[model samples]
Target chain A: MGSSSAPWKQLLLSSIEANSHLKHHSYFQLATVSSNNRPSNRTVVFRGFQDDGDKILINTDTRTRKINDLKHCPFTEICWYFMESWEQFRISGVVDVIDGTTPDPLKLEQREKSWFASSLRSRVQYVGASPGLPAVASEQSSQSPSLDPSIGPVAAFCLLLFDPHQVDYLNLKSNERLVFTSIASDSGKKLWTSQKVNP
Target chain B: MGSSSAPWKQLLLSSIEANSHLKHHSYFQLATVSSNNRPSNRTVVFRGFQDDGDKILINTDTRTRKINDLKHCPFTEICWYFMESWEQFRISGVVDVIDGTTPDPLKLEQREKSWFASSLRSRVQYVGASPGLPAVASEQSSQSPSLDPSIGPVAAFCLLLFDPHQVDYLNLKSNERLVFTSIASDSGKKLWTSQKVNP
Candidate 1:
């Protein structure tokens, strides 16, 4: 069974709804360990869940350093805070990068769909100069030509599928915390166990 | 030289001030690597800068898992987002844990001052059950006695000093990004170099 059947998904969905008013609610920090064993973190906009599963969707430029870090070590932690409710969800998982060269048919389709789901403005960013490179003065002033949405995700547009193994949910308002862990069952199914803990 | 003298400090301060109206601006996400090599992340309240330096101050219970992670690996990354300005500051640093057992007199003094700086309600949490433990019904309902403010930090109260070496500042509103790196001079002074990068 996919993580959609996981027990923590409901609580996560509810928390998202609770903080829907805030535009930044969908933004979260993703942490990964570089090859040198140093921790790196940055903010990424939540693209949405993949096919009703608990796997998170995050879009990024393939040229970014995080892509290289993920190649070295797929393990990652996502820290998402819901300001209105003062709730935090720390999800620990391994990320799978689905880029232009992805071989999986299903993943490629998902990546293509995600490309079209993005706003034209967001898609424009992928066609521009590579992220983290020194900005070119001439390119900065030039108007970005609109991307052909039908062409699918640009080479630079990469989709990260975060497959979570653990979710630590903390609600400050209730002064409660719960940890949900995913376990593989004898039938090769995914099962989640949750325990209430002190916040 | 302290991180306060770094060039990125000014931009960080301005972003913090721009979002001062939002109470949650003081909250940031901290990422660390566990001994097992997996990345761990959580939201941490920003206490303040240490003295006139950019050593970031954060408080946590000694019983928390983060303390163990720090003991195993001091390297950490702090991701702070300012919603109003649509800016993000990713700081890479090594963390110093200062608890009651700390031998450094000056470090212990800072920890004591940090303890007193916390609100009475916050101090009461240190006297309660250890965090991340299963909640006990009786213990959860009982009223927590006020902690003595005069007494120094409780054994559980720990201070974390984050000494930053690199800062990545991204401003989405202006579509600009800058990287600040700390370089040590031959005379032992810390100097910062910044480069404008594509967002």
Candidate 2:
């Protein structure tokens, strides 16, 4: 029952603060379950996180394999590497999908804008009107909308919320590995003691 | 039948050149097979690559789970991500463990020095008297000549070499994903072109 004031807690906070660019780090290696329960991994960008550090948010297209996997199995592990320092942070947690119906409007707007900016609308059209859709080519050829259209109302996007249960922080400087397990109780949030593991 | 001058090849060459930091970017995600045949991935630093991009090398301790898995299944996939930009490269191929007995003295020296610097002799002493053996508390009190020495010599330091068979280059900016497969012949001395899958 150690408090969050432990050295490990400070280390985690300082690491993230010192490496502020990690927030905008383009890709994170995401591990998800496949149809047969096998694991598959891909890189995805980091969106942001909550102020309380209770949850982290990421954006992904609906067409991606990870989105489909998240629909089935919410358990996931995310690996983030800092290129400059050769430090790594591994987080294992449960993922929750947040859609337009989410309570917070600010969160919804941020998610929508990010998704829209990352969409492949122009490229999708260049590839010729969605491969499988039959009638779309004819309709598009008849009266095509401009290439750079406004974010349409029909566009659908979602935000993924990752609540970490365990975080393994490894610093290559001293080849040191530290594991921090986060537990939330009725009183408040508490981080257990850190264990030094073999690197 | 396309030549190396194809768009994908140019794209890859340009990406590698533009992102010069990538060559020095140490962290890479490595996927290895577990006992259950499932894939387990973790971060490892990139040591170097061959002149022709034929082989990629990584420094690993014999005690790591990845090295153990490689003993059982030599097939692995390495994912390299450049955080500053949305560029990622995936290399899947067979792994060859190169030991100190390797003919190339330069490679041997590089591997040994990497392991020595990474060992942090202080922590190695805490682990145990024998280099590879874990230090037992009772045996910890016993003094041995080996105890004063560095673990680099006795440790089974090996270089994990991955000869690329398939490569997937993804540039999120242009929404372009390029997949290239290579065919190796003559004991990996010569390579041939294979089909390029649509990305």
Candidate 3:
């Protein structure tokens, strides 16, 4: 089965697997366009893949600059760098927000837990509260009340998903460099096109 | 007289130099938009920087896929990864072809040499030429065409100059992450706006 696959497909699968395996350790720099046409990029944790690899998911507090940028402009691009190998992978796609719901309760739970853990610090950082303040400190002492009924509903935030239709892969070897591109149609079939450029 | 500067200005100057220096290495990635409204990104060499310190130049041949994408769209984003320190810098701006007769000779020379020196191996790799040839000779013969003229110009052969308006810096530490943004105006004034975000 593996041998039957095209070279581009094989390379893509390997690269994606390598990237996803390094999800926890990888820092993804995501760029989103604002309504004013300016682009904004930030470092985000790679939450995981979804829709059978058709979509990539990331978790972030809804209050962050990225979320605001996404709201203004749904088009975004993401870059993942593997320093050890001097390899880089870039994904550009449309951003769609998804709330926790049916068809994947376990996935929803996992995402929620991750969000909670990640947001514990965000709550303090955004409000200018001292890091020394306890998580359960008084509402005034804390940036915002964690248990605020009014904010809780809006707080269960998740960056729905961004699906890349085009991806570029670059590998820098000691003396040679390789570049390839994969473009997928809406039906999910991918057309692989590649060229080597002067490095 | 231009040597001494205030602490803040000095810091800015040093950062710009450091950032430009990092791009001189073997690999870097740039994000551009496609006609289909999707984002396209690929790795390109860090050709060099301009004397103004306001723009960065990258080399590309006329036959590359990215050039085709750019012909359809000019808005682009770029991400630079510093291998040793795990530091990343991202910029979003408009990409324009630099005219050879522009006022700055230093910038022109740097870019010209970058394009002129792109390897023959890179050209073969860019065109997907290796796969069509026999396996045995492909590996060995790939190195023999270091001087072929066909390797010089790909579709993406023009020099890409990024006129940046904003830059985001991310530094990963053992326990904490630092994130900040700096914006430059037309008047050559740069203002830094920072925020400590949760890792």
Candidate 4:
């Protein structure tokens, strides 16, 4: 099976299950490129891991500049550094943006689920000007700023699926560094090719 | 002077001087782009501000991938997020790499100064694998790792000068977000054009 063959995948799975370092700090630094090739990065909350650790989940406001950047330049590197363990995972992947207004029922469910998970204050941010607009002193909206999930940007909070191309797991605590690239088996099942890389 | 007209520059200067929230947390997240436009990011320790806040400094190994990336794509956006104050500063700029091997006395002085400030363990990192090299179990080195200012990658430890193009300051505590752009003044003096950007 895909799960058994990949040692790197198992390591990531165990870390997620342990949840010591990753639970409290789900915010990973997300990097994206502008049209002119300038690198822009900011913090993004990790939603969850998908496909037995084959893919990762993150949500974004459809109006945010990063979502726009992803459309133009789809490749991104999301890095999560664990302070306690001193481990850093550099996951390089291409993204699939599940548009908020999509007619597909499966993606629609994801948007609704993401909205419910988001805090009232976070939901309020998406309904406002698309993220990077020039600031106004205080954006006064009579929209009541309700905590109700239905009242937020139910249509603007999009789902971004990060499908990994490669994962570089570095144990700064130790001298071991591993790189894993996803490949396929003879039977056409997806698997990983793991190797110890120079850190 | 360029410093007087720019309140944003003053704000950054004061923050650095006050050193409350930013003191121990000087590691700002650095984002860079590859030739193929894939965005990669990592955390970089802020060395200091230069040119009256027009430029900032950070030191890194010349053999690292980031320095290589900068050589091809000079534009970079550095982000410093103050967790305690709920303030974020996004600094976008080009880089000027001061090679450690420079014979110039002024450039050599910076390398020497930076070396003195670096910890013994940090100096060890420069001598190992040039960073990002595929790991070979435990890297065995017979040469004793020393804290001497002349030792390690003094030749490989490059000073990266980030010359600002623009700076976007956002206060999550308040709704105020401002973007400042660099411009030349009437007398060929470099100044900034401050604006109230939408947040």
Best by DockQ: 1
Residue-level lDDT tens digits of model 1 in A58-134: 99999999999999999999999999999999999899999989899999999988888999889988988988999
lDDT of 4 at A196: 78
Q: Model 4, A45-138: lDDT tens per residue? A: 7777654556778877777788778888999998766544556778888998887567888867766776777677777766666566655446
TM-score of 1: 0.96
Q: Which structure is stronger by TM-score: 1 or 4? A: 1
lDDT of each: 0.90, 0.60, 0.54, 0.72
Report candidate 2's fraction of native contacts: 0.07
Off by over 4 Å in 2: A1-13, A21-26, A33-40, A50-53, A68-75, A84-86, A97-156, A182-191, B2-16, B21-26, B33-40, B50-53, B69-75, B83-86, B94-155, B182-199
Models ranked on lDDT: 1, 4, 2, 3
DockQ of each: 0.85, 0.14, 0.16, 0.54
For residues B1-199, write the lDDT of model 2, one tens digit per residue.
4343323445545555676755345567876655555445678766656544557777665566666778777877677776556677776678887666678877677566655655454335334433223335565346532443454544556677776667777666654455666654567443444332223
lDDT tens readout by residue for model 1, B147-185:
777777899999999999999999988888999998788
Best TM-score among the predictions, by candidate number: 1
Docking class of 3: incorrect
Instruction: Report how far residue B50 has shifted in candidate 3, in Å.
Output: 1.9
Better of 3 and 4 by TM-score: 4
Report lDDT (Cα) of residue B180, candidate 2. 68
Q: Which regions of candidate 1 are displaced past 4 Å?
A: A1-4, B1-4
Candidate 4 Cα misplacement greater than 4 A, ranges: A1-24, A137-144, A151-153, A185-189, B9-24, B101-105, B138-144, B150-153, B186-188
